[model samples]
Target: MKLAKHIKSALAIAAIGAASSAQALVVDGVTWNPNALNDFSATDAMYESIVSNIGDVVSGYSLVTQLNGTASAVFCPGCELTMTFTGYQLANVTLMADLVTPDQYFFTGGTINIYVDSTPDADFTDPTTYGDGILFLSLAAHTMGNGYTLISSPTPQVGNTGNGTGYLDVVGGSAASNFNTNKYGFAYTGNTAADFLFTSQFQLITNDDGDPVCLSSVNDSPICMQGANTINGNSIPEPMPLALVALGLFGLGLQRRLRRD
Candidate 1:
């Protein structure tokens, strides 16, 4: 009995040590250290995939990273990251008829800004210049919206690409011009109610011009776009280390009681 108790106690100690070593590295709300960008395989893939699959219909798209709270003193505490999706596809399906005859678009170049609130401050717009708490990606011109939206339903469709909601607006132009410059805007809301999960599903609209079309707001339509392809299912932070420590303590206590018996 004494030998068995000793073995159990040793196991418990090992578990405690293992748990401590496996603790995740976190700064602010982000899990991946921006300084060590190359260390995160998933994040690197996400960026590359977005650029490579520009014209392909994006089935699952999500990019999640931590903001650098230490970079700026004005940064909001406990502020969550946000993304917005706006364009013709997100609008009412019926509005498709209103689009140009070719009914195709390509991605050009654009910038996505991360802000603590809906309105971005001037300092937060450019990642290259800002030097902290920013993410920059090379996106094609015609790409619609990218990101995730929380649903009230308890069980979210994990891998379903068309699972969320979107709206529509008019992109008006003559047949010759094709309203090439007009573009739509999708905005993200920072709500820290849950862990951050960025997701998107996109279909490339090929056109004769082969140039990107900018989104122009004309009117609002009901939910149109749905389905997200890539979801950061692992975005949620793990439970506190105390929980593991407690389990270790429980094992130790059990071993002590058995030895006493």
Candidate 2:
């Protein structure tokens, strides 16, 4: 993370210091941009095969690190997100997690399935229109239990790219459960009403084959994935009240000193 970005984040949190406890369990407005990635390419009469095989590429990579990031302050696992990507192909995408607390988090049971524009690939990109194109992905609530659930929405269209949107929830436990989704990205477990707090800092990898419009790597490997993509800074409670308490005592002491003088 850059120093300026860190300052901005701190200031943002400070600005919202007095919002309320309920809203405090949230990290907002996090962004990640890869400094360098490879482009993609494809051969003649092989566009369809390339698209289908892109998943192979997407699955091979993982998010490496975050340029600017934070760890989760609270643990609530029933958290999920729908990330939208613009100017990028939809077929070759992947999500990775960084466990804040390994034993407490699980994203998609170790695997993430993709959706195109809110519909399953089988339906959205049917054999007819299943050609090559960019689309949005939606995260669904698949893993549900007393202590955990997933939440997510489709990303809207942005310019030529799609906007990704997602949600996180608390399924079980309380704010102090010490079990949080603040894993690398968005991965955790929660019970009904558990306070889930997550910091968006991780990777978004894409499978880029050798195509004219692909992201490639320096080693001639396609930029199959984007690592360490941060979003919605991790939400943590600010101890402003503790500071206020100390300040109040100081004020009282100062008043007493003046009276004695």
Candidate 3:
């Protein structure tokens, strides 16, 4: 992803096509413009493992791909972000949808536990004080039910990196760059009441590849990110039909599972 970062994601989706699809930036109710990924290409896949969802191990990798031909588009779709790193200080990103819900989430702070599903792995519970609640989703909705896109918060404290979300022990800034945050960088754009959207643009490229410092901020986001590190590009163009049954069931790998091993 570097035609100068696709011209910085095509000028951040052309500022969501000059905004006003109700403050544009959505996926399920469909409004995300970046021409809804016109020229959407593929090759994405990645995998690693340490596993945790508030269990604290927080390091597993999976990057599967699909979203067929015909220039695609779909939105406010929930879950699929798992970031956290060191060196560049990107420290939190978990909007998960591994689907495991039985419903029973509670966390008091230091010694109160009860997690069923939806990105919870800190080995003791503390996803940066757990504030954005849907508790980091595990399919709370929008599996085509037509609702549920997510963008979370709470992971402040950048410079010396002492926020809440990412706290794995890289001792530099593994998970401790803050968690589940995404202030700008990729220059977000999910309005129409955006529920969630990140089909797969897994980020992180700074060793001089440039664009880090917590994504340089539209607000801020960092802490735990993953990518099989495969990338290619181009497009598709379905305005609706539920965005062609939500990316044709993610290009028939059935809600994503083309390859993860």
- For each of the candidates, give the backbone clash count: 35, 53, 59
Q: Give TM-scores for every candidate, taking all chains together and pairing residue i with residue i.
A: 0.26, 0.24, 0.18
Indicate whether candidate 1 or candidate 3 has the larger lDDT: 1
List where candidate 2 sits over 4 angstroms from the true fold: 1-163, 167-211, 217-221, 224-230, 241-244, 249-261
Q: Which predicted model would earn the best TM-score?
A: 1
Please write out the lDDT profile of model 1 over residues 98-161, one tens digit for every residue.
5453222233222222222222232212222221233322212233343322211111122322
| Top lDDT model | 1
Error of 2 at 147 (Å): 13
lDDT of 2 by residue, 42-156 (tens): 0010011111222221121111122233211111122211222221122322333563322222223212211112221222112222221222111122233422232221121
Ranking by TM-score: 1, 2, 3
Using lDDT, rank the candidates from best to worst: 1, 2, 3
Off by over 4 Å in 1: 26-95, 98-122, 125-127, 131-261
- Give the residue spans of candidate 3 off by over 4 A: 1-33, 36-55, 62-64, 67-261
In model 3, the Cα lDDT at residue 180 comes to 26
Using lDDT as the measure, name the better of candidate 2 and candidate 3. 2
